[model samples]
Target: MGAHDAGTAGRGRGKRIVVLDYGSGNLRSAERALAHAGADVTVTADLTAAAGADGLVVPGVGAYAACMAGIEASGAGPVIAERVATGRPVLGICVGMQVLFAHGDEHGVVTKGLGLLPGGVTRLPAERLPHMGWNTVTPPAGSVLFAGLPADSRFYFVHSYGVLDRAALAEAGVRVTTAHHGTDFVAAVERGPLSAAQFHPEKSAETGALLLRNWLATVD
Candidate 1:
């Protein structure tokens, strides 16, 4: 059993949604999307504030090194560390997802990630640079993470790197793969209560909204 299943041994009992804001991210739109899904989300840069919140969304954009620095600087790092320790759901998106791993190989810069999940982040296949477009995501059989989500659902993506190795894929209990420019990448991931999606569900039209709605349903 992973940290999520262990920490969340008892059912969740809170409505506080903490969305981390270090320097940049699409939190504003994510907030709008979550609200549309009936979630009362709270956006903050304070790690302390995020630590105590019921659920946390670690979203990021731009440089991975800079984002990690911002998260550490804001003190949200330990909060996330603790949250992961608690087994409560902590979702990271895009660069946010990269942060969950031990490290990343981007911009020739190898920096440590949240180390929440067991693995390292690597660059996407050479065939694909920054995968920027729409694609279909097919989730694994036992995945309820995308419960009610349509199969082969299309989602918008603009990412350069993704989880590539099979071991890394298994770390994510429910493996959700998405195709980008003929290359397959892990679109959505969930390791126990810890979940994340490289594609911006907030921008994924109905498919994205369905993901958000499903996640929101598990918030409390």
Candidate 2:
């Protein structure tokens, strides 16, 4: 039950993509961006709506633990897992991407994550903290997410913690894209049925729009 049917035009013309409202994320911005990218977008917390959508987008902001709590409270974690299990598409943004890992460490505290990816999030080792603002991404070969984009394309980022284990992700057969703050960290990940970005695509302007379009193309 993807968004658009077979007859719809390109982009998300008839597609039904849901922006999960798990009590986190820049919902309106994401919704608007996806709509512009041609999806029939809905921002909701309804489990049925999330599960039934053609494609699901899990967007998040703030702490990893708080986002995970909202996902649990909304009963959306199982829905996301089910979607992944069934080979349906799911995209996570920012902390949405972070929580998909095994766990996240903020300050000295650690919290369990969705454990979808075999990794943990930790503070970026750069000289400066937060790793905010725009940075260029180095997409892997044959990267569907970065397809048609420039090699040095910049994406918006506002993060303090990220997945730093590139080797583990590669060993797990996940396609990765990296960006450097002071050191390298996972900027994006593309595994079967699951794709996530540490940066906010909705806030990334044209480059972000193109990335969303690429992901939307895989919805069917």
Give the Cα lDDT of each candidate: 0.73, 0.90
What is the overall TM-score of model 1 with all chains considered together? 0.86
Task: Give each model's clash number.
Answer: 1, 6
- Candidate 1: which stretches are off by over 4 Å? 1-14, 126-128, 171-182
Expressed as tens digits, the lDDT of each residue in 102-194 for candidate 1 is: 777787879888887766667777575677878777777766567756677888888787776656557445465545554566677776667
Output the TM-score of candidate 2: 0.95
Q: List the residue pairs that clash in candidate 2.
A: 2-54, 3-15, 3-16, 4-14, 4-15, 12-38
Q: In terms of TM-score, which candidate is strongest?
A: 2
Query: Model 2: per-residue lDDT, tens digit, 1-220?
Result: 2333232226567789999998999999999999888899999998999999999999999999899999988888899999999999999999999999999999889999998898999998888878889999999998989988888789999988999988889999999999998788999999988999999999998889889988998898
Relative to the true structure, candidate 1 has a C-alpha RMSD (angstroms) of 6.4
What global local distance difference test value does model 2 have? 0.90
